[model samples]
Target: IFFRSAMALQLPSELWDIIADSVQSDSLAHVCRRLWDLLGSSRYVKLNCDSHCVTQRVRPLARNVRALQVKVKGPWDPTGAIDALQHAPFLHTLTLSNMAADVTVGSARAMAAIRTAPSLHTLTLNLGRNALGTDGAGALAALKDAGGLRTLSLDLWGCAVGDSGAAALAQLKDAPALRTLTLELWGNAVGN
Candidate 1:
């Protein structure tokens, strides 16, 4: 009904902010372009799109966004995704979740991108059922360099980091501004 009708309309991009779940995979870039075109007049300031759908759509709006949440559906490609985020200059908080088993190098590169995000202070990487391994651990450990970061949440319940991964995370003691850290490894071999 309403969802279908909205999807069919050719309304101005400024009309997107009022529609919930207004993002459609095929039309993301067009909407972003319209938003950019309407810059000051457009009230839509926050965006949540399918991580895969926006991979190609993000570059145009990168400099205008304030927050971003990327949900990986299949195997993660760290380099490609992180490379896209590098264009976002005003990003504050980033949340990456629902990653698949192949998210090794991509996960690391993603963390590295967060470290360089000047305004990023809060990061949440939900790797509950993915396979991050030692490489993932090293990548996450590198985030301590993000000077503005105050909180970090790592959910590695079923990943492959094991005890060595735990050791890697323990090295974060030097992150002076990190006030809270939550690591979820309940189902993983982190204790072994």
Candidate 2:
């Protein structure tokens, strides 16, 4: 009875706003299908998707997505994820990772998409054990344009980034609002 009544309750849009603001839409959406639909337009949903089916799942929920996490497991084609992000204009946080050697310069294209998202405040990328050399780090320099980005955690461990790549990364100091920055470049060729 409690579950049915809760689902059936039709509160005013104002009341719903109060409820939605205090609670995360991701957890509420998991309670039932009705709640998911109710929160379909809420900008608090945290969505997790893999490279495969990312376009399908993210496109529909793009407007509602506040945080997004994508992991590249198999072949690393960034096209789908890039397309999906274009629709998510309100997305504030993003986490992308590929823990294998296959993640290559294609990730540079992903950075291009990221640079345009002004609403994004936090970004975490773990592209470890790949072959993204100086060029890839140079691509990351585009984050200097992300005016709202406050936190950035980049794990390019063993991605063959030498001194030149480090210099490119140093350009992030120009990001206006960035307050916290973490770079994990261990197992690389960066020198003093």
Candidate that would win on lDDT: 2
Best TM-score among the predictions, by candidate number: 2
TM-score of 1: 0.69
Candidate 1 stretches greater than 4 Å from native: 1-52
Q: Could you give candidate 2's per-residue lDDT for residues 1-192 as a string of tens digits?
A: 644676555666556545765675556555567666776654654444455765676567666677777665654667666666655777888887767737666666575567666478999888888888988888877877887889998898988878999888888878899999888988878995
Q: Candidate 1 — what's its lDDT?
A: 0.64
Task: Give the RMSD in angstroms, all C-alphas superposed, for model 1.
Answer: 7.7
List pairs with backbone clashes in candidate 2.
none
Worst 10 residues of 2 by lDDT: 42-51
**Each candidate: what lDDT?**
0.64, 0.73
Model 2 — TM-score against the truth? 0.81
Residues 1-192 of candidate 1 have per-residue lDDT tens digits of 543454535665556543422442223334454433543221223344554665665555566555666666665455655676665665666777755546675657565666777767777888776677777787788877778778888887778787887788777666768888888877667666
